[model samples]
Target: MRDQDVEPFFATLQAANPSPETELEYTSVFELLAAVLLSAQATDAGVNKATRRLFPVAGTPQAILDLGLERLEESIRTIGLYRTKARNLLATCRILVDQHGGEVPRTRDALEALPGVGRKTANVVLNVAFGEATMAVDTHIFRVSNRTGLAPGKDPLEVEHKLLERVPAKYLHDAHHWLILHGRYVCVARLPQCWRCAVRAYCDYEPKTPPPGDRAG
Candidate 1:
């Protein structure tokens, strides 16, 4: 995409939703980081459902440590990879308590050092928690980026780097939210809802999904 296209793309997205935010439900950065970690291979609704109860009782690192791995696992066992996620979350909380004064770290290195916190998870935490301009390339963003020619790349890291360079400064902060929402609702994996897409005009995708019952209108 061109420089001009970058600005207009974000303009349309921003116009549709003036204040976009991550769907992951959390009251604090620690909660947000924990939520993102558990969200891997899981849906927002699933993560929210699990965290709603967990956060109230044990959101902080010390609190989570108190909850213990067994209880934590039971809380989020409803979601996939719950066992692994529980272990990672517990370990991460321990690290945060011992190393970072029980606070969620702002730097990527610090965040990534936590168990289960990968590049994508760190990016999400950094962007949402710290207002950093980082892109978390999930399946939805990966598909949308390549399909729309927004920042086409074979891998998530490649797409993330390209997006960092190409995405305009004005849109950098909210790019993750906008793209995730768009990919989740409009530019879907199976059948894109082209009719409802707000940025369809700027999208460079060929053979766009036809409107329902169009009869070649």
Candidate 2:
């Protein structure tokens, strides 16, 4: 996509939803971090379902650490890879309590050092929790960026960097949320809903898919 089209493309998305936010439910940075950690290979709805029960019981690092591993596993067992995620969360909580005084670190290096946190998780925490202008290129964003020719790249990191470089600075803070929501709801992997896309005019995807009823029988 040309530099000129980038701003309007994002402007269209911004206009449709003035304030985009992560679907994952959380009241604190630690909770958000843990939710994102558990969200790997899981849906936001699923994570929220589990956390809805889990958070009220133990929302903080210290509280979660006090919850113990066995109970924590049981709490989040509804999520995929719950055992692994539980273990990572426990270790992460320990680190938060020991190293950071039960606080979620703001720095990328410190955040990534947590057991379950990765680059994407760190980026999400940085952007949403701290209001940093960072992109967390999940599968949804990855697909949207490439399919729309917004920032085509072979991998998430490449797409992330390209998006940061290409997206208008004014929209950088919420760009990830907009792109991820668009990909999840509109530019889906199986069949993009190009017929009703807000930015369809700017998209470079060829032979855009028509609505289901419009398809040939």
Candidate 3:
């Protein structure tokens, strides 16, 4: 999309959903971190299902460590790659407890140092937990960024950089949530529901798909 169109595109999104948030259910920063860790290659709904069961029993870093590897694995076994994620969670908990005094780290470097935490995960924690203007580009954001001509890039990092530079400062903090929700429910991967997209007027996607059974509209 043209640089000029970027504002309205986001403006439209903001107007539709003024207060977008991550779908993953969490009551605290640590819970948010764990939920994002478990969310890899899995749906928010799926992650929530497991976390709903796990967090109440073991939400804090110390509680999780005390839960032990075997039990942690069993708790999140419903998610994909449960064993690796369990090990990573336990290891990360140890670091948080031993190094950070059981509190989630605030800096990107500190957050990334934990096991199972990568650039994307760090970005999410920084943005959502700490209110930073960071973008955690996922498959949905990648698709929406490219598909909408919003901030197209070959990789998530590139897209993230572009978005940071291009997105209006006013919308930067919440842009990530808007894009993800748009891609998830409106500009879907299979066939974009353009006919009903709130920002269709500002989008760059052409020949917008019409309502069902009316592709030529």
Candidate 3 residue-wise lDDT, 15-89, digit = tens: 999999999999999999999999999999999999999999999999999999999999999999999999999
TM-scores of the candidates are 0.96, 0.98, 0.97
Model 3 / residue 29 / CA error / Å: 0.7
Ranking by TM-score: 2, 3, 1
| Cα lDDT of model 1 by residue, 84-168, tens digit | 9999999999999999999988899988889999999999988888888899999999999999889999999999999998898
After superposition on all CA atoms, what RMSD does each candidate show versus the true structure?
1.6, 0.7, 1.3
- Identify the candidate with maximal TM-score: 2
Clashes of 1: 0
Residue pairs with backbone atoms closer than 3 Å in model 3 (clashes): 1-149
lDDT of 1 at 124: 93
Preferred candidate (TM-score higher): 1 or 2: 2
Tell me the spans in candidate 3 whose CA falls farther than 4 Å from its real position.
none
Q: What pairs collide in candidate 2?
A: none
For model 3, what is the error of residue 19's alpha carbon versus the real structure, in angstroms, after optimal superposition?
A: 0.9
